[model samples]
Target: MAATLPIIDLQELQQSSSSSGKLREACEHWGCFRLINHGVPVSLMSEMKKVVGELFDLPIPVKRRNVDVLSGSGYIALSSMNPLYEAFGLYDIGSTAAVHEFCDQLGASPHHRETILKYAEATHGVAMTVAAKMAESSGVLASDGAGLFEDWACQFRINKYHFRPETVGSAGVQIHTDSGFLTVLQEDETVGGLEVMDPSDSGYIPVDPVPGTFLMNLGDLATVWSNGKLRNVKHRVECKEAAVRISIATFMLGPPRYTVVEPPAAFVDGGRPRLYRPISYEEFRVMRQITDKQAGEALELLQGPAQPLSTKFDVNSLPADVLAQIQDID
Candidate 1:
C-alpha cells in the first residue's frame, strides 16, 4: 500500500501534546502534512481563489506584466521548461508595501487587491505558527517566545495547471523539492493531481485535496536547518483530467535574500553532525538554477564534505591527562 499523507488539525495541535509529536514526525518522516482549521478565513480563501483564476485568465501580454524585483521571481509562462504550468510570484509576502507593489504590477482591481492582502496576512500567520511548532519540536525557544521566524521573507506563487484531455497521464510539473523552509499551499478543491515521492524512495502518494484546509510541505531549507532530520518532501504534478487546476503557495523562504541560511547551533552536536556549508537563500537558488538542479538531488551538491574518521585512536596509548594536552599539537 502507498504511504498516507499525514493530516494534522490546527485546533487539536493547540490543545494536545500528541499533535506536537505528529508535527515533528511529519517534518522528519513525511516533510508534508495537511493542515485543517488553520484560521484563514473561508470567505477570504474563496475570494483569493476567484482572483487567482481571473489573473491566470488574463491575456499572455497582460500576464507578462507581472515583472520581478529579482529575475525568476515574476511571471512564469507555459513553456517547454514547464509546458503545462504558468504562474506569477510575489517577492516578499511579509511586506504590506511589497504586496501593494505586486498588485500594481498586475493591475489587480480593488477587490482582488483586498483579497490578496487579506490572504497575505493569513499566510504570514500560518507560516509563523508552523515555524514556532518546528522550533518547539527541536527544543529551540524563540528569544521572545515569538518573532524569530517573523523576520523571514516569504514568496507567494499563484500557479495554474492547463490540463487537457490529450495531456492526461502527462506530467504538468516535474518532480522537485521546494527550495525554501516550508510552503503553505491552497490546492484546488476539485482536482487531484499532486503527488509526493515517498521519503523511503519506494513510490509516490497522491495528495487528495481536503476542503477548508491548507497543505504544508517542508522543503530543502528545512533539511538544512534540521541537520538532515527533516525529509525535504519531493513532489510533482500530473494531468489526471482535462480540468484546469489553480493553487496558491506561500513559501517561507527563510531570512532575507542576502542573509546566511544556517542550521542552529543546537542542530550541531555529538551525533548530529552539521550537514551543509552556510549559503544564502539567493545564492543557493542561483546555484540550483544555473546547474539545472530543480529536483531533489540539488541538495547533494551543497552538502558538507564528509570528514575522515580518526583511525589511529587507542585509549590505552594516552595518559590520564594526555587527552587534554593533545589539543595543541598542530
Candidate 2:
C-alpha cells in the first residue's frame, strides 16, 4: 500500500489534545501533513490560483523586473537544474512595500494585486499559527514560541511547472529539504505530482492533490531548533503529466540576521544534548551555499561537541549598527 500524509485538522488542534498530539507526532515522524480548516477561504484560494496563473503568464521582461531581495528570493527562470520550474518570489511578503513593489514589477492589475496581498496575509497567518503549534509541541513555552516567530520574516514563492509530454516521469524539482523553519504550501488543486521521501523506508510517497487543504512541512531550521527531535522532510515535484502546475509557498525563514538560531532552553537539557551550535541565519545560509549542501546535509557540518547551556551571545555586546538593525526587526 502507498503511504499517505497525516491529515491534521487546524480547528481540532485548538479544541482537542489528541489533535495536538497527532500534530506533534506528524512533526517528529512525517515532518509534514495535510492541514484542513486552516481558515483560508475556499473562494480566496481559488482566486489566488487564478492570480498566480496570470502572474506567470506575464511577459518575461516584466517578470525579470521582480529582482531578488535576498539570494534566490526573486524571479527564478527555468534553468537546467529545474528545467520545468520557474518562480516569482518575495523576500518578505508581510511587508506592504515589498508586496506593492513586486506587484509593480510584475505589472499586476488592481484586482490581481489585491488578490496577491490577501493571499499573502492569509497564508502568513496560517504559517505563524502552525509554527507556534510546532514550537509548543516541541515543549517550548507558548510565550517563547510567540517570541521566536513574532518578528521573523516569511519569504514567499509562487511557482510554476511547465510540464511537457517528454518531461513526464522526470523531476520538476530536485529532491531536497526546505532550509527554513516551516512551509505552508497551497499546491495545484488538479495536478498530482508532489512526492515526499518516506522516512520509514527511504522510498517516495506520492502526495496527491487534495482540494480545500494546505500542506505544511517542517524544515532544516526546525530540526536544529528542536534539538534534532523534529524531522526535516525531503520532497520533490515530478512531471506527472503534460499540464501546468502551480504552488504557492510561504517559508517561515529563521531568525533575523542579527540573531542566532539555537534551540530554546526547553530543547536543551541534561538528557537531550544540543546537537548544533549557535549560528546566525545568514552565516548558516552562506555555509550551505559554500558547501552546496542544499538537502539538509549541511546541518551535519554544524554538529559539534555540546557547549554549556548558559553559553550565549550578549545583545548589548553587539555592534551598534547590528543592534539598530535588530531593533528595527523587532
Candidate 3:
C-alpha cells in the first residue's frame, strides 16, 4: 500500500485530545502534515493564487525589480541548477511597509496589493496559531502560549515551476529541508509534484494537491527548538506535467533579531540536556551559507557535547507508549 501524509484539522486540534496526539505524531515522525479548516478563507486563497499567477506572468524586467532585500530573500531568477524554478520573495511579510515595497517593485495594482496584504495577514495569523499549538502539543507551552511567536520574523515566497512535458519526471527543485521553524504553504490546487521523504523507509511519498487546504512543514529550527524531538522533513518538487505550478509559502523563522535560538527550558531537563548551543538566526543563516549546508547538516555541528549514557535519555527516540509512561510518571 502507498504511504499517506497525516491530515490534521485545526478545529479538531482544540476540541479533541486524539487530534492533539496526531499533531505530536506528525511533528515527531513526518515533520509535515496537511492542514484543513485552518480558518483562511477559500475566497482569499483563490484571489491570492490569481494574483501570484499574474505577478509571475509579468515581464522578466519588471519581476527583476523585485530585488533582494536580503541575500536570496528577494527575486530568485531561473538558474541552470534549477531551470524550472523561479520565485519572488518578501523578507518581512508582517510589515505593511515591506508589503508595499514588494508591490511597488513588481508594479502590482492596488487590488493585487490588497489581496497580497490580506493573504499575508491571514496566513501569518494562522502560522502563529499553529506554532502555539505545536508548542502545546510538545509540552513546550502550556497556559501561556500566546506570546510564543511575538516579534518573530516571517518571510514570504511565491514559487513558480515552469513545467513542460519534456521535463516531466525531472526534478523541479532539489531536495532540501526548510531553514526556519514552521512553514505554511498554499500549494497549487491543479498541479501535483511535491514529495516528502518518509523517515521510516527513506522513500519519497507524494503530497498530492488538495484544494483549499494548507500544508505545514517543520524546519531545521524546529528540530533544534524541540531539542531534536521534532523532525525537519526533507522534500522536493518534480515536473509532473506540462503545466505551470505555483505555491505560496510563509516561513515563521525563530525569535526576533539578535535573539538566541535554543530549546526552551521545558525541552531541557536533567533527562534531556540542551541538544544545541544558543545561536542567533543571523549567525546560523550565515553558517548555512558559508558552509552550504542547506540540507540541515549544519545543525549537527552545533550539537552539544556527548553526555554520559546514564545522564540523559532520548525522549524522541522512545516509543510512544514508553514516552507516555514517562510523561505519566512526571
Better of 1 and 3 by TM-score: 3
Candidate 1 TM-score versus the reference: 0.87
Worst 10 residues of 2 by lDDT: 321-330
The reply for model 3, stretches above 4 Å from the true place, is: 16-18, 142-146, 305-330
Residue by residue across 1-330, what tens digits does model 1's lDDT show?
677888888878877767888888888889899898898988888889999998988899988888664544578778765567778887778899989988998889999999999999998889988888877777665653356677888888888888989899998777887878889999999998999978777488889888788989987888877778788888888789999898888988877655766677667788877778676666665555546677657678767673212222232343433221111000
Per-residue CA lDDT of candidate 3, range 177-202, in tens?
88788999999999989999998898
lDDT of 2 by residue, 1-330 (tens): 887899999988877666778889999999999999999999999999998888888888889899753554677777665478788888888788889998998888999999989988898889888888777766788666656787788888888888999999888777888878888888899987889989889999989888889998888888988889899999888788999888888888877764778888888889988788877665665556556687789799778774422324344454543322220000
TM values, all candidates: 0.87, 0.90, 0.88
Best by TM-score: 2
- Going through the candidates in the order shown, the clash numbers are 0, 0, 0
Collision pairs in model 1: none
RMSD in angstroms, all models?
12.3, 6.1, 9.9
